[model samples]
Target chain A: MDSIKVFAPGTVANVACGFDVIGLALDAPGDEMIIRRSEVPGVRISAVHGADLPLEASRNVAGVAVQALLQKLEDPKAGFEIEIFKNIHPGSGIGSSAASSAGAVVGVNLLLGEPFSRKQLVRFAMEGERLASGAAHADNVAPAILGGFTLVRSYRPLDITALHTPKDLWVTVIHPQIEVKTSDAREILKQKVLMTDAIRQWGNVGALVAGLYQENYDLISRSLEDVIVEPIRSILIPAFHELKLRCKEAGALGGGISGSGPSVFMLSKGEESARKVADTMNQVYAPLGVDYKIYVSQINTEGVKVIG
Target chain B: MDSIKVFAPGTVANVACGFDVIGLALDAPGDEMIIRRSEVPGVRISAVHGADLPLEASRNVAGVAVQALLQKLEDPKAGFEIEIFKNIHPGSGIGSSAASSAGAVVGVNLLLGEPFSRKQLVRFAMEGERLASGAAHADNVAPAILGGFTLVRSYRPLDITALHTPKDLWVTVIHPQIEVKTSDAREILKQKVLMTDAIRQWGNVGALVAGLYQENYDLISRSLEDVIVEPIRSILIPAFHELKLRCKEAGALGGGISGSGPSVFMLSKGEESARKVADTMNQVYAPLGVDYKIYVSQINTEGVKVIG
Candidate 1:
């Protein structure tokens, strides 16, 4: 085949309380890309969906990952025509950069006869992120590539491990109409933390980890609390507290900001509860006169994949 | 038999990052208690334990739980001879109170014709802890009663969950001679935390939990990091930095205080590493002139049990 089309789903990064370390794949529709073999080594890019992202290899996430993967080839002369479908917006806490980077790597590497392991491909995707975010962190890319729940333990060695997310977990995500830039959100964070808050956070961290292994839903729900980030970031999202309170009251297991916010997500027990949570959230936002989107989705165990 | 001899194992409470929530039972070498039949409703306590623990029913951990369990009976008339085999030290962060409580509940429950479930027995144990610490936290008691890694989501309604622990994890613990009270150690902590650190702690928590399920040893090792409690508590364990440094240099997977401890525990790849870690810790404490106790053990899956 001279060309291929691949679909990369949206993802939730910084899983509440787990920030920057945990990323989960979302089944909700995301971005797409089509890559075709060409004679030039560098990628030629175009976007069909997202608003005016730079096409230059130096500026775009997908462009960088494809470039890195091609440079790995014996014949650096290999080229590709890349078309991106950007359905999930940047700063949505849904791994926008990841969907782009992962899509490009998965699509291009397939065109290259699949010489690299999935881990190698994920590493290649890291370069895609380096151009945009000052640092190359794998939280987003790792899950987009490997699926399920993922942990980016170390960035230096680029260690990425996929975790077993419980089968029963249902995720409800709402992206508000308001826009919050990723860089701006990151800038708001303080460099240093208080010692006391740090201990509570760690204690919750300890409890949360134990909860997941034991599949203790109640423990996981209690541990879902974010005394640290959620309080700070919720201010950026519209109706954060009211919406979250309503969702929990409507039977959510727990919920918090999705990444650096403007987007919020909640965990619900079953389909019925998930639907109830979604309705409750939308109801709270109804009076805000803001255009918002809500997705009552399950945890996307199967992540990025083929869609022709 | 006028009195029956029961052995309750020492345990590592608040295993690493699992503060206030996780704990486990150890093999062999623990506290021993003997309880004999009595004619009255109230529990009379006696401790063979060398430490100056109070022998009165209202003051002793064992006596308290036995007293509470008997109080629940319609016929409150119960009598017993209580004897304790003091193997685990009270302030060692090995679940001293938990062992005593579990032993008391076990012996008395057997005497009362087994009125409760194994879980119900844990509830009885928590009652014992209330007489000691103002809070009836079950991180220690649940694990001691049930064995393995226990998650105490809430102490109020008594929600406890047991998690699977990987068999390959060989534990190496170093208990220095210095003593630090849990209350005092707890007092050193601040009530608040930085959002960033809290996020990282939870991420590691999820990673650690996922690691246990996936049997990803490297992830388990990496996730073993305790960024919050260790730094504060380690200050009390003289030369803790050197001991940790040596353990890492000798190739241990990362670790921290066994509980709220003077005891440092690290999980290793195998028996050799476990022994090496023990030796390294011993060497680090030599200059400090602190005598040490060591456990070159493995994760104990079996929890509270009567001495067979």
Candidate 2:
């Protein structure tokens, strides 16, 4: 096919105690990218929408990823015109850039007749994240490319592991009308973490992985405590503490700042509890008079997919 | 039954990247404890053997743990005579203290007609660990009581989760004739850890949990890295780096300092691989002209149990 379109789901990274390691794909608020054959010898960002990202091929995450993937492909002379429809908002702390990057690589790979593996695709996509966020992290990219829950086991070799996720699990996300730059959010974090807090964080991370595999909701909730990152990052968001408390009161298994957030997400046992969490989170934001968007979604099982 | 005998399995806490969270029980070199109902009004340590543990109720880990359990029992007035046979060596970093404490609690609980749940028993056992290590951590105790692979999720609630363990997995442990005080081991560790190291550590921890659940041997080996505690603690053990490299070269999936040091453990894919790993590790320690003992066993499916 000369033309192809792909859908890449947004993702939630860090997943509370799993800072910089764990992430999960979402079913809504993703991005769609269309790649069409062109006579030009290089990738070009032909169109953009929903967010004011750069049109420059080198600056755009999708273009950067596609370019990286093309350089590794045996036939690097192929030309493609990319059009991006960004449904996920940038700086929402919900992996908007990852969706664009993942979608672009997936779409371009399909156009090239699938020369690279999903793991290789993820590496190329990470270059996109590096362009967007100044760090080549796979927490967002891996899940967006491979789906469900993912663990960026190590970065040196770019090892990523897909983990067990419960079918009944639901996610509730609220993107408040605020922006927290990824670089700024990251900079606010301390260079060093106390050994005490680090131990607690690792314990929760281990338990969270076990909880997912066992499909134990209570274990997941109890293990969601983020002693390391949340305490530092949540301060930037308004009513972050109350939002978490209300989300929990409304039956959220657990809630925390999504990514680096003004966006906050919660996990629940079922759709009803997820909607309840959304309602509670929205009610808090409504009183604060900030425009917000809410999504109640099951975990996205398929990550990047050919849409057309 | 007026008297009961229980055997508590030895455990490897920290499990490389897991730090103070993940642990697994072994099949051999455990502590055996005997508890008998008595007319006295309190728990007492009647006899001790195979080690230099104190016989005083408050001083001994087994006695201290049993005492803590009795305080919450309605029939606290009933006394119990405890005799401990320590087969797991002290300062071996193989949960020696935890085995004694866990075995005591399991034994006395059987003598008291099994009123408490396993979780409560672990809590009481943790108090014993505090007496031995001066820290109320439960990585070793939880696995010794819960069996298989376990995660100590939280300390405030004493939350613990039993994770899946591959049936073919094998453990190899070697304890050199050296003592690295837990206090000294802990002291040598920095109060603050670099964020880079902590991220790598937690990533490995998450992947390790995923590996156990998925039964992926390569994932297990790749995720076995420990950047937080191993570097600091391994220095206390002689030829630690060579031991690890030799163990891996001999077919160990992964290996590291068990708990604080003086002992190292490796996980292999099968019994044969475990024996190879043990042989390789022994070759390293044997040349040091130091006394050492090797154990090659499967993951203990049962924790503390009535053997007689």
Candidate 3:
């Protein structure tokens, strides 16, 4: 097996009130994918530090996307060697699987001479996602592939559209080492929400969208409040309130749990506030003895850069 | 005693996701206020017709706002005799009370030689709403008084800001005769929400704002969805699903409960679709004994107009 390349940027899903539908790509700390031409029409996979994912085409996410892309190409007689430099952790709620799926789809498609639209590539990536999450949800993959602010309207056929993202918006992500499985986190949620809560949710949703478009920081800050899921989920992550309060005090507009648990994100206007938010999150975890990784990055405008 | 006339147009409050915090003014079918400068102090009010609102100074919303404004003046000696020319119906969920309050406050304040600022007028209008609804919320009043799109940060002392509304957007409001008591409607609501729901709300909110800024109709239509409130509240309004389906079919972007009740608002691009939406709404309600009133209006850039 020789060498080839694929890259997928990190993403933030469940952004504010757009759960399961909205996501944005981050500018930094993305994974690099390299795929080499191989014989026998068979695929091989390797993560950073020689960490190997499954080789079976049906079981591996990257493998499936690659296979899907290759199938779309005529003469599936050629195979490829794939390598992923995994900067984004698997359970960070930062579009971990999305990176792999998106990277594989893009990388393999690139190797096969780009035949699909980015939206078209979404379905191939979504098929790859079903291997890990047991379902194909494009909130992560759509944004990772399309870049900018994205919305996945329909999950089945994959209707992905990129919304306008403000230029100066800064994002800070703090992933506490504790793990909360997405399935478990989802199971804990009540299926039926109260009428009052629903109204409040939509009310905040409207405000948040308006805030983003108008660049109204105060409205965005106020709209950042999530009375619905945050109260329950925050109970799972200790020091949640402390981090939020400290981040707000540190001049960060607001921050909340990233996706399901443990990882909390803070959004601010400038570098100072972003750095301050990171420091605040670090301090909150100190006494709790929870070591964590911090990501201070801008909204990723260019997603899935292939390593040459 | 000479009566001074003022007018305030109907408004849409809660503006989807900025629940209880955001609202926009409408252009037509507003309420007219007649304020008589009198020697009888402490502010007096009488409702001739419209919405069956209370006539007493304490119970009447207009009376309350007038009192709030006059009480602030030294030697609160100016008496107010208020009358309403009710165009917008009560329980229409179209910021009915806010129109009267804003108009009364504006009328009486003008009689008193313009003593307070516009923000102060919003505060004064809240007094009226406080008396009627038992809560001081400026989401509607702020916009009716100031015009355009207004964000109500708080009600106590009333923190308000105006947004620049795009020129091309048209609004279609359908008021079905079904009555859902505001107090009872509010009581059935839950105090908590899922954090995930909150994120979705903010995401839609962000999208809506972006739609407005870009004046992108399809994007605005997509962003117009109310996953949180519309779902729950529309349950109370019969044929809500059918009504929304019809509105969208008729060329409106999306439809949701206007404020808290039987009325539904559909946003459209131009005159044709807006008219079509009103017809569709009427068609939906005719079979349910929900006699309806419909308004085809622009963004209502000028919130309140003074009647000569």
Candidate 4:
């Protein structure tokens, strides 16, 4: 195929107690990209839509991600042109850049007759993440590429595990249209945490993974607690506490900040409860006169797929 | 049943990255107790053997545990006499006190016509834990009652989850005849830890739980890491670094301090590998002129069972 079109889903990272390690993919609010072979001997960003971003290949996330993938080849003579139709807003804390990065690598891999496996593409995609966030973190990119829930077990040698996801799991996310810079959100966190709180966090993380495997909703709800980062970062978002309380009252299992701030997510057992959570989120933000966007979707099983 | 004799399995608590939350039961080197209905209306410890311990009802771990269980009933007039035949050495860091505590509750519950579920016995068992260690932690008691691998997800409400155990999983434990007080171990650890280390720890805990459910041995090996407590606690155990290295080299998955220190445990995929790991442990400590004991057993599927 001379050209390939693919759709890459957005992701929710730092899932409650699984800060900086666990992430899940969403079905909606993704980015679509079309990558084509180029006559020139270098990668290029042909065009972009729905967002104003850098057109330079070296500066664009997709461009940098595809370059990382091509560099692994022996000959390294392949060239590509990429066009992005962005739907996920940048700085929304819902993995907008991950979609672009994951999609670019996936499309290029397919166009080259699939030289790399999906797991291998995560490191290439993570390069773009490094360019975007200054840290080559895999919490978002792994789920975006692998689909479902993922755990970055270790980073020194880059180990990632795909965890079981229940079919009934649904997500409701709201972006309050306020900017919470990732750097600032990260800066607010304390360098050290109490051993008591750390123990509590890992207990929840282990239980959450067990709940997913057993498909036990009550266990999942009890494990969705974050004592370390949420208390500090939640202050940056408007109506954060009220939104969480009302969403739980509306039948959400539990939730916290989606990634860093601005966007908050609640997980429910079924789509009906997820929609109710979205409605509750709307009610909380409406009175505050905050411009917010809501999206209710199931856990994305297919991370990035060929659309055309 | 008017009288009940029972066997309660020993356990390894704080299994690597699951400090303060996780534990697994062992098949051998447990405690045997005979609990029978007494004419009196108060708990009593009638006989003790194989170790030096208090005989008073309130002073003994098993007596304290049985008292806690009886206190839950409105008109708890039931009195019991317990005879202990201890096999697991106290302060070996392999849940020695837990075996007594768990055995007492299980035996008494059986004599009372099974009024409480096995899960309900954990809290009463934990009262014994509090008496032994001054902290009511359930890592050891939960596994001793629930069997297999167990997670104490939370303590305030006492949430426990039983994790899947691979069929071929085996354990090798070496208790170096040395004293490493639990209080000393707790006192040595810092009150706070770096966020980076905490994230790495939770990542391993989550992945370890996932590995258990999936029966992925390689993943289990990689995730059996203790970055927080092991570093400082290993200093207390003689040749701990060497034991871990030699165990891994001898086909063991990975291991660390069993509970606090002195005793070390390694997990292997099968009984044969577990035996090999035991031989390596012998090679390490036999030359040190340090007295020690070793046990090799399968993962206990049944927690505590009535013998008569």
Candidate 5:
């Protein structure tokens, strides 16, 4: 096929206890892209719609990710033009850049007759992450490419493991129309943490993975705790504590800031509970007159998929 | 049933990536205990064999643990006499005190018509741990009581989770004749750790739990890494680095200081591989003239079991 249209899903990183290590893909609020073969010998951002983003190939995240993928080709003869219809807003902290980057590489890989595996595509998408936020973090891109739940076991060699996802798991996300820069959120964290707290955090992380594998909802709720990053980063988001408490009271298993956040995401055992969580989010934020968007979706089992 | 005899297995705590949170039970090299009903009104340590230990109920770990269990009863009228046949060496770092404590509680519970669940026994066993180590850490006792692999998810209100145990998994452990006090080991560790290192450690913790559930041997091997405590504690064990290197070269999965030190343990995919790892351990330690004892056994699914 000379042209392919694809939809790439957004992701929730950190997952409470797994900071910089775990993430899960969402089923709604993604980006749609059309990638077409071009005679010109290099990548190009031919068109952009929905969001006012740079069309320059060198400046765009999708362009950077596609270029990184192309660099692996032996002959280097392939070229492509990408058209992005963005639905995920940038800096909403729900993997907005990851959707663009993951979509671009997945679309190109298919048009190139499937040269790279999904895991390899993650490496290319990481280039986009690096361009977006000065660090090559795989928490967002790994799940966006591989789907469901992913654990980045190591970063030096870029090891990623796809964890078992429970069929009943659903996500409820609320993105407040406010900016919380990833860099600033990162800077607020302490460079060192107490060994006792670290032990507790790792304990939660281990139990969380086991809970997912066993499909034990109560275990998952008990394990969804973050003693490290959330205490500090939540200060940047408005009404963060009340939102989390009310969401959990409304039957969310648990949740925390999505990525560096103005966006908050809660996990529920089923779709009905997830929808209830979304309504509770509205109730909490409505009093403050905050502009927001809410989505209740099943856990996305397929990351990037062909649309046309 | 006025009298009961039981066997309580030893455990490898910390388990590389899960410092202070994870542990697994072994099939052999455990402690044996005989508990009997007494007309007396309180717990008593009546007989001791194979090791030098205090006979006073308050001074003995097993006695203290049984006392803790007895205290939970509303009437508090029950009394017990415990006889110990110690096999696991104290200060060997293989949960020696835990076996005694767990065995005592398991035996008494059985003799009293089974008053407590295995998980509840962990709390009473932890009182033994607190007496032994001056800290109420559940890593070792939780596994000794619950069996297989156990994660101490939280210390407050004490939460324990029993993880899946792969059928083919085997353990090879070598205990060098030396004393490494748990208190001294705790002092050697820094109170604070770098955030980057902590993240990598938790990543491994999450992946290790996933590996256990999926029965992915290679994934387990990759996840058995300790970036925090092992580096410093390995110094206390003689030729630890060389032993670990040779064991891995002999096709063992991976390992480090078992519990607080002096003993080193390696995990292998099968019993044959575990035996090979034990041979490698002997090869590494024989030339140094270090007196050591080696045990090769399968993962123990039953923690504390009645013998008679």
Candidate 6:
């Protein structure tokens, strides 16, 4: 195949108490990228849309990820032209960059007859995130590549475990117009978390995993608490606490800062509840008069895939 | 029933990366207690064996736990005589006190015709543990009461989620002839864990939960790292590092400080591997010339139950 178009879904990272470990993919508002063999012998970002992103291969996450994937190919001379149609807004904190990077590598892998494993694809995508976020974190990228729910069990060996997610799970995400730089959102966190808070978080994280595996909605709701990261990162977002409270009151099992800030997401038991949560979140944000967008989506079972 | 005997299995709390959230029950080395109705009102410790223990119902964990159970009984005036047969030694880091507390509550609950729910029983047992350990932690006690793998999702509402334990999972526990007081074990830990170590620990915790749910032994083995608690606490135990290494090399899936220190346990895929791990651990400790006991058994599915 000369070219392939792939769509990668947006993802929610650091799900409440999971901090740097757990994340899930959203079925809507992802990035679509089209890759074709180019006459040039190197990867290139030929076009862009929706958001102003760097076109230089080395500077762009998609470009960087695709470049990493290309190096391992038996035929290293392969050239790629990429067109990015970004639907997930950049700096929205809902894994916009991850979608782009994951989509690019997944597309390039398909176009090259699929040699690398999904874990390798995740690694390549994480490196893409590294170029964008200045940190080699895989919470978002892993889910975008693997789909459903994922756990980055260990970073040293790059171990990723695909967790069991309930089929009826729905996600409601709202991205405000305000932008919170990932670096700034990360920098505000303290270098040390109180041992007490860490213990609570550990309990919640374990319970959240159990809830997902058991398909217990009440357990999931109760486990949706981020005592450490959220207390610090929520300050960067406008009306984070109010949004969370209103969302929970409106039937969201639980919600938190989607990635860093600006965008927040919640999980619900069903489509009805997810919509109700979105409506309530919109009602809360409407008075603020901040330009924002809302998405109600299922937990994406299939993460990044070939569109055509 | 006039009298009842119940056994609460010993448990491994923290489970390496899980710290204070994840734990599992072992089949052997548990505490057995007998509760008999008396004409006098209130609970009392009737007989003691195997260890020097407090007889006061309020001062002792089993006594304290049974007292909590009595408060909830329909006839608070119902009297109970308790005989404590502590097969699990204290200060061994293998949930000795938890076994005592759990066995007490389970026995009393049975004697009173099982008036409390497992969660309530866990709560009462946690209170029992509080009298033993300074903190009201439930990681060890919850599993001891509920059986199998258990996660204390939240302590505020006292939420405990019973996790899936692999049926073929075998555990090898070696208790060296030494003591690491729960208070001293906890005191040695720093109040603040480094952010990097905490992140690594969180990833492993998430993965360990996923492993339990997925029944992936390899994943569980890979996730059995304790970057935070083990580093500081292991210093108190002799040959902890070498024991862990030898156990892992002996085909053991994973192992770590059973609860705090002095006693180390490893999980294996089958009984053979478990025996192999126990032998290796014994060899490592035999050179120390200190007395030690090793128990090789399966994961206890039935936690606290009526024995006779």
User: For model 1, what fraction of the real interface contacts is kept?
Assistant: 0.53
lDDT of 1 by residue, B1-308 (tens): 44666777777776666666667777644677787887765778755666678888888888888777776765655677688777777777777788899887887777667777778888778887787777677877887778776766555556677777778777787777678888888998766555555555655666666677777788878777666677787898888787888898998987888778878787888889988988888778777777778888776676656663
DockQ of model 6 vs. true complex = 0.79
Candidate 4 lDDT over residue span B1-308, tens digit each: 67889999999999999999989999988999999898888799999899999999899999999999998954457889999999999999999999999999999888888899999999999999999999888999999998999999998888999999999999999999989999999999999999999999999999999999999999999999999999999999899999999999999999888888678999999999999999999999999989999999999978987777
Worst 10 residues of 5 chain B by lDDT: B70-79
Worst lDDT 10-window in candidate 6 chain A: A68-77
Q: What tens digits encode model 2's per-residue C-alpha lDDT throughout A1-308?
A: 99988888989998999888899999987888889988888799999988898999999998999889888875757899999999998888889999999998888888878899887899999999999878898989999999999999888888998989899999999998787888789899999999988988888888899999999999999989898889889989899999999889888999688887878889999999999898898788888978889998989978998878
Candidates 1 and 4: which is better by TM-score?
A: 4
Which one is best on DockQ? 4
TM-score for candidate 4: 0.98
TM-score of each: 0.90, 0.95, 0.83, 0.98, 0.97, 0.96
Output the lDDT of residue A95, model 2.
Answer: 94
Instruction: Kindly list the per-residue Cα lDDT of model 3 for residues B10-47, writing each as its tens digit.
Output: 98886766566667888876898888887788777766
Judged by lDDT against the true structure, how good is candidate 3?
0.75
lDDT of 2 by residue, B1-308 (tens): 98988888999998999888889999988888888989997888889889987888899888889889988886757798988888999888999999989998988887877899887899999999999988878989998998999988787877888889999999999999787988898889999999989988888888888999999999999989998888878888889999999899999999788888788999999999999998898789877988999999899978998988
lDDT tens readout by residue for model 6, A1-308 = 99999888999998988888899999898888889988787799999998899999999999999888877775757999999999998888889889989998888888777898887899889879999889878989999999999988777777888899899999999999897988888788899988888888888888888899999999998999988988888888888889989988898999898888688999999999999999998899999979999999999988998888
Local distance difference test, per candidate? 0.76, 0.89, 0.75, 0.93, 0.93, 0.87
Docking class of 2: high
C-alpha RMSD of each candidate structure in angstroms: 3.0, 1.9, 4.3, 1.2, 1.4, 1.8
In candidate 3, what are the lDDT values of residues A221-305, reduced to their tens digit?
7767665677777887878887888889998887677767667888898777898888887888878887788889888776777
Q: How high a TM-score does candidate 3 get?
A: 0.83
Off by over 4 Å in 2: A38-41, B39-41
In model 1, the runs with Cα more than 4 Å from the true position are A72-74, A190-200, A206-216, B1-4, B71-75, B127-135, B154-159, B190-196, B249-251, B279-289
* DockQ of each candidate, alpha-carbon based: 0.46, 0.86, 0.29, 0.94, 0.92, 0.79
Return the interface RMSD of model 6: 1.1
Give Cα distance to truth, residue A66, candidate 5, Å: 1.5
Cα misplacement distance, residue A198 of candidate 4 (Å): 0.8
TM-score of chain B of 4: 0.98
